[model samples]
Target: MSGIEPVEHMARISGGIVNWRKLLLIAAVTLVSILYIPDAEQLWSAWLRQEEFSHGPLMFLVALYLLWRRRVLLDYPDRRGTILGVGAILLAVFVYALSIKAGIQNTRHLGFLLLIFGLFLTFGGVTYARFVFPSLILLPFVVPPPSFLNSNLSYGLQLFSSDLSVSWLRWVGVTVFQDGNIIDLGTLRLQVAEACSGLRYLYPMVGLGVLTAMLFDIPLWKRGLFVGIAAGVAIIMNSVRIFLTGLFVEITDMGISEGFFHLFEGWVFFLFSFVVTLGLCWITLKRSERKSLGRGVMSVPEPTGREPAPMALVPVTVALILCILFLPLATYLRHLEPSIPARASFNSFPLKINGMIAEEDLLPGVEQEILQLSDYFLGHYRTGEGPPITLFAGYYEQQSAGKTPHSPRVCIPSGGWKIEDLQTISLPRGDTTVPINRVLIGKGDQKLLVYYWFQQRGTFIANEYMAKFNLLWGGLTSSRTDGALIRLSLPLRSEQEIPEAEKRLAGFTQEVFRILPAYVPD
Candidate 1:
C-alpha cells in the first residue's frame, strides 16, 4: 500500500506539470492570435493576390516544421527567460500600435515578427531562441515589399534587362535598338514591362537560398555567398529569357513573347536557374564534407522527461500582461477615425496665377481610381513664350496603406523617364526657405525639371521618410493624417535652358504655394 501511494503521488505531480505547460502554451497562442489575426488575414490576402508573395504559405509551413524540429531545445537544463525578452515584447507592442495608426503594412509585418521573437525568447531563453532563429526569420519573406519599393526596383530591373537583351541580340547578328525598356527588333517591338522584370524570380529564389543555407551545415560566409549566387542566377536567367524572346521574335513569331508559351518559358528558366545555383553551392563545399550537408544543421539531442522551469514563468507572465494591457488600446486606435478638416475644393482653384495663362486638366478616371485622392489639381500654365509649366497637387483627407500619394521619383521612372540628376534645393519663401526635391528627368530627347514637396498640415517636408514619420506622429497626437503632394515641372529644350527652366519653376511654385493652403488646408 505504501509503495502504491508513492507511485500515485509521482503520477499526480507529472500530470500537474504537463497540464500547466499545456495551459500556458494555449493561453500564449490565444493572446497572440487575438492581437495579430488581422495582420495575418492581410498577409493571406496579399499571398492570394500577388504572384511575388505566392511563396508565403509554403514558407510559413516550413517555419512551423523547423520549430517542431527544434522543440527539444526548449527542455534544456537551466532554461530561463531574460529581461531583454521583456523589453522586446514591450517594443513590439508599441511598434504594432504605431504602425496600425499610421496604416503602414510593412511595419505591421515587422511588428508581427518582433512579437513572435519576443514571445519565444520570453518563454524559452537564449539557447532555444537561437535554435529557432532561422524559423522565425523566414516570416519577413512572406510579405511583399511595399508598393513604392517594388515599383522602383521593377523599373530599374526592366531597363537593365532590356539593355542586356539588346546587347545580346546585336552580338548574335540580330539588329536591335534599345530605348529605355523598349527593345526595337525592327519588325517587332517588345517592351520589357513590369511583369517581366524578374522580381517574381528574385524574391522567391532569395527566400529559397536562405532556407537552403539554414538547412546546410555551412560557414556563415558560405551561406551569404550561396544567397548572393541565387540572386545573381535569378537576374542572369531573367536577362537570358529576354534575350531568347527577342531571338525567337526575330527568327520565329511574336507568339513566343505572350500567352502560355511565355509563361512556360519563364518557369523553365527559373527552374534551370535554381538547379544551377544549387549545383554551384554544392561544388563550393569541400569534397570530403559535401556528403554531410545537413548533418548537424539545427540538430540537438532529444531531451529526457522534463518539467517547465519556474524561472520562465516570470517573463512569460510579464509578456502576456503587457499584451493584454495593449490589446484594448490597439483596438481603440484601429477604430479611431482621423479628423478630416473641411477645406476648399481643388475645383475652386484659379486657372491663372502669376501672369501665366493656365489650362485645367483632369486625370483619367482610371488614374483617379488608382490614386484614391480626395481632391487633385492638374494645370498647364504657359507664359507668352517658352514651354509650359505643369503643376499637380494630390490631396488625401486620410492616408492609409495603398491609398497614399505616389512619389514622382518612382512615378517618373515608371513612365520611361530616367532621372538624370536629383537633389533637394531650397526655394526662398518669405522669411524662411522652403525645402523641395528637384529632379532632372529625360526620356529620349525630351527633358524636364521637376520640383516637388509634401505638405502635411502647415509643415513642408522634402524627405519621404520624414513625411511618414510626421504622418505617424500626427495620427497619434492630433488624430489628423491629412496631407498633399505638390509638384511643378517645366521642360528644357537644351542644357543651357536648365537655368531658365529652374527660374520659371521657382516663380510658378511661389504662386501655387500661396493658394495651396486654401485647397489642401493647414
Candidate 2:
C-alpha cells in the first residue's frame, strides 16, 4: 500500500475510535444515574413480579435509544466543560449526605437530577441540544414530587374530579349532593379518594409523553403544547371515567361503580388518553410540513465507523465504575435504620392518640374501627382503613402536632353515640382540652375520632417524619387490651391483643426512630 493511503486509513480508524468513546460516555453516565430514579425499587419490583406498572425500565431504554439514534448529533464538534459536570457530581454528593442527615426520602432522585442536568450541560457539550427531550422525560420519574406536595395535589385532584363528575351528572339530568370529595347520587355515593384521583395515570402518561416527544422532532412550542394536551387528555378522560362510573351505577341495578369498575376505569382512561394523544400528534403533523415536523423521510448517514475521543472514555469509565460502587450503597442507604429520634419521640404529652382496632360486631360486614385520641393533635379522624391512610402521611403530624401557627380546632358535636364523650382521660394524664372529631358514615357503622392540642409554633412541612409517626400510630391502634381504656366490642376477640398491638407498634416506631430519635427534651 502507498504511504499516503496508509495515513488515510489510520485517520479513519482514529475517527471511529472517537465516535465509540462518545457513545460509551453517554451510556456510562446514563447507567449510573438511572439507579437513582425515585421509584427504582418499585420499577424493579414491577419487573420482577410482572405487575401492571412494569413500564419503568423501558423508559430508560428508550432514552438510551434516543441518544444512540442521534449519534451524529452527539458527535458535533464543540467545547467540552468537564469542570461543570464535576461540580454537579460534587453538589449531588453534598445533597445526598444532607438528605441522609435530614431523612429526605428521595435523596437519590435529587442527586440523579443534578447529575444528569450537570452532565448534559458540561460533558454533553453541543449534544445537550439534541438530548433535552430525554432529560425532561426522565425527570418526573426520577424526582417524584415530595409526598407532602403529592398528597396535597392528590387531595386537590380528588376535589377536581368530584366537581367534574358532579357537573357531568347534572348535565345528564341527575340530582347530586356534593360534600367535600364525595358525591351523593340518590342510590349511590362516590368518594373520590386516592384511587380515583388519576395519580396512578399521571406518572406513566408523563413518561409516554416524553417517549412521544423524543420520537417526533417538533418545534419547542408545539412540543410543549402537545405534552400539555396529552396530560390534560389523561386527566379529563379520567374525570369522564369517574362520571361514567357514577352513571353506570345509576343506570344498572348491579353495583358496577364499586369493585371491578374501579379496576376497569383505569384501563379505559389510559386507552382514551392514548387515542387522544395519537390523534393530536397526527393533527399536528398534518398541519405542519412533514420535514419541519420531523415526520418526513429522514436521511441515513454512512457508517463512518468513527471512534469517540480518547479523553471522553476515561471519564465515562470512571463514572461507570463509581456508579457500580454506589449502587449497593444507595440500596443500603434506602434500607438504613431510621434515626432514634423519629422512632422514640411519641411522648408529646397533654394529648396523645393511643390506638385503633376493627370492630366487626359494631357494624357487621363493614369496617368499624376507633382511633385513640390525644390532645397533641387539634384534629379529626381521617375516614379510611389501614396503614399510612393518606398519600401525604407526613402532613397529619403538622395538623396533629399543635405546632402550626393558625390551625383550626376540629370538634365533633356528637360522638356518634358509640362511645360517650369522656370529659376526663386518665392515660398519659394532662390538663388540656381534648378537641375531637369523629364521624359515622359507611354502609356498616364506622366511627373514627382524632383529638389533638390546637396550637402552632411556625410554618411546618410534613414529610417522612409523619410516615414514622404513622408507623407507630397504626400499630398501637390495632392492638386491643383485655380491659384497656378502649375495649372495642368484638364478635370473637383474642387475649394476645394489647401486647401484640403494642409490640407491633413499637417495632414499627423503632424502625422510624432509627432515622429520627424521639424528641427528648434537649
- On TM-score, the leading prediction is 1
Task: Quantify how close model 2 is to the true structure by its C-alpha RMSD in Å.
Answer: 12.2
lDDT of 2 by residue, 1-522 (tens): 687996885675456654564566567566665665554564365445532234567766765665565545554423365445556656765566445433444544566666665555444543443354354455456345555455555656666777888899999998887765667887877777666777767666766765565455566676667677777876887788888778878888545556646665656657667878878766776444444444411212433544333345444444555556656765665565432212222233212123432121122221111121221112121224433211001112322111111211111221112233333221221232222122222122333222222111211112233433443343233221110011111111233343443344333332322322232210
**Total clashes, candidate 2?**
44
Show model 1 residue runs off by greater than 4 Å: 1-19, 259-261, 264-266, 296-299, 303-309, 362-372, 414-416
Question: What's the lDDT for all of these models?
Answer: 0.79, 0.46
Task: Provide TM-scores for the models.
Answer: 0.90, 0.59
What does candidate 1's lDDT look like per residue over 479-509, in tens digits?
7889999998889898799987777788888
Global CA lDDT computed for model 1: 0.79
For candidate 1, report its TM-score. 0.90
What lDDT is obtained when candidate 2 is compared to the true structure?
0.46
Per model, how many backbone clashes are there? 0, 44
